[model samples]
Target: MAVQDRGERSRRSILEAAASVFDERGYDAASTTEILARSGLTRGALYHHFPSKEAIAAALVAAQSEALMVPEHPVRLQAMVDLTLEYARRLRSDPVLRASVRLTVEQSSFNRPGMTPYRQSADAILGLLREAERQGEMLPGVDLEELTQFIVGAFTGVQLMSQVYCGRQDLMARVSTMWRLLLPSIATPGVLMRLRTTPPPSVAGAEGDGVREGDAETDGTARPPVTPRAPWG
Candidate 1:
C-alpha cells in the first residue's frame, strides 16, 4: 500500500475504535488502552493519529455533524426537518455520532479546545434557516439565530431523553414530533401545511413510517422549483 493510504487506514481504524470505546464507556471512563485494544493497533499507531484520549474525543465531537447529511429538498424548511430526522435515524446505528453525542454531553470530563458540537450544529441549521427565509418559507419576524439555538437545544434534550428511555429506538419519532410542535410557530402557514414531519422511505430506515403519497404540494402553493445540490449521506 502507498504510504499515505496506509496512514489513512490506520487513522480511520483508530477513530472507529475510539468511537466504540467512547460510546460504551463515555469520555470520563474511556481510555487510550481500551481504544488501542479495540483497534488492534500498536501504541505507536494509535498515537500517530490521535495524541491523546481528549484529542480523540474532540475529533469525534467534531465529526458528529457529518451524520446529519440528507438530500436537498425543494422546500428548504423540509430539508432542515430532514436534517434533524436523519440525525435521529443515524443515532440508532452510527457509532461515531453516538460517541460524539456522549462526548459532547460529557464535556466537563475532558478538555475540548475548539468550538463545541452544539455550536456547529446550530450553525448548520442557521444556514438552512437563512435559505428558507430567502425562499419565503419562514414566518416573517422569526429570529433565525434564536430559532436555530432553540432547535439545537431542544433536539439535544429530546435525543438524550430518547436515549435514556428506549436506547434511542424512538428518536426518529420524537424528533418528528418535535418538528410538528415547533413548525407552527416558525413556518409560514402555507409551508406548515405541506411540510412533512416524517422522513421519506429511503432515509427513514426500519423504524420510520416514511412520507405518504400526495404529501407534497398539498398546501396549494405550487412547489417552487429548486436547484439541485449535492447529496449528503
Candidate 2:
C-alpha cells in the first residue's frame, strides 16, 4: 500500500510538474528531464508510471481536465456559465493549459482524435449548457449543441487572442469581459438569478460536482461543424 501510494503520488507530481513545464516551455520544446526535475523524481520513477513523453503530455492535459472542469452548483444554468468562465479563467491563468492554448489552433489535431484536451473541455462545458437548458435555465428555443459551440469558440478565441496580442496584464480582464458580454444573452434570467443566489462569487472556487466532459465535434476522422463564431464577436 505504501509503495502504491508513493507511485500514485509520483504520478500526480509528474502531472503537476508537466503542467508547469508545458505552460512554460510547451509540448515541442518541453523535456522529460525538466519534468523530472520539477517533480524531484528520477527518470525511473517517472517511467514507472508513464511510458513516453507524449503520454506525459496527455496525462498533463487529463490532469487539467480533472482540475479545471466546470462546477455543478445549485443553480444549474449559472453553474454552467460559472463553470464556463471559470474554465476560461483557468485556461488564461494556468500555465499547463496556457501552453496548450496552441492546441486550440490546430483543429485538425484536436478535432481528429480519440480524445484531446480541447475536445474534453468542449464537451464538459457543453454538458453544463445542456443541463441548464433542460432544467429551464434556458428558454425552449435553445439549441444546446449550437450554444455549446458558441461558448467553446468564444473561449478558444479569447485564449488565442491573449496568446498573441495581450499586453500581459489584462488577460484575465479580457476573459471576464468576454464572459460578461456573452452570458447575459445566453442564459435565462431565472436560471441566472438562482445561480447567483446559491453561490456568491467569493466561494465559487471551493464547490464542484467533479464531472468532466469531452468535445462533441471530435470523431477521429473529422470534426462536426455545429456552432458558428459567437454572435458576440
Candidate 3:
C-alpha cells in the first residue's frame, strides 16, 4: 500500500511538472531535463513513471479531459453555461489545464496524430445540447449538432485569444461575453433569462475552495445569483 501510494505521488508530481513546463514552453520547446528539474525527481524515477517525453505529453493530453467539471442543472442549457464558465475559471488558475490547452493547440507541431481533447469536449457539449433540445430550452430551428461544433470552435478561439492577450485572467469575462452572444441564438427566451453569463457566487467561491465537480449540485444550491453580469460592452 505504501509503495503504491508513493508511486502514485511520484507519477502525479512528474505530470504536474511536465504540465507547467509545457504551459510555459510548449511541447516541442519543452525539455525533459526541465521537467525533471521542475519535478525534483531523478532521471530513473521519471523514466520509471514516463518512459519518454512523448509519453508524458500524451499523459498531459489525457489529463485535460478530466480537468473541467460539468455541473448538473435543472436546465441543461444553464448546465452548459456553467460548464463553460467553470472551465474558464479553471483554465485561468490550473496549470494542468493550461498545459492541456497548449498541448491540444500545438499537437501538430509535435507530430501527434489527433486532437482528441477537442473531440471529447465537443461530444460532452453535444450531449448537453441534445438534452436542452429535448427540454424545449433551445430556440426554434436550432441544429444541436452544428451549434455544438460552433460552440467548441468559438470557445477554443476565445480561450486562445485570452491566453495570448491577458494570460487568461480575463477568460471568465470573455466566456461570459461569448455566452451572451450565443445564448440568444441557441436558447429560448425563458431559458436565456434564467441563465447567468458569469458564474454565480457559489460556483465562483467553490472554484476557490477546490471543490470537485458536481459538489454544488449535490448541495442543491447551484442556482444563479441575483445579480448576474450584464452583457459585455
TM-scores for all candidates: the values are: 0.83, 0.68, 0.88
**lDDT by residue (tens digit), candidate 2, 22-117:** 666556677889888999999988888889877775555555565455665765665665565555555544565554554334432223224465
Sort order, TM-score high to low: 3, 1, 2
Give the lDDT of residue 30 in candidate 2.
71
**What's the number of clashes in each of the models?**
0, 2, 0
- Model 2 lDDT on a 0 to 1 scale: 0.59
What TM-score, to 2 decimals, does candidate 1 have?
0.83
Which residue runs does candidate 1 get wrong by more than 4 Å? 113-115, 205-233
Strongest candidate by lDDT: 3
Worst 10 residues of 2 by lDDT: 212-221
**Candidate rank order under lDDT:** 3, 1, 2
Give candidate 3 regions above 4 Å deviation.
107-109, 207-233
Model 3 agreement with the true structure over 141-170: per-residue lDDT tens digits: 988888888999999999999878967767
Best by TM-score: 3
1 or 3, greater by lDDT: 3
Clashing pairs in 3: none
After superposition, candidate 2 runs with Cα above 4 Å error = 68-70, 92-94, 97-115, 163-172, 189-199, 204-233
* lDDT for model 1: 0.77
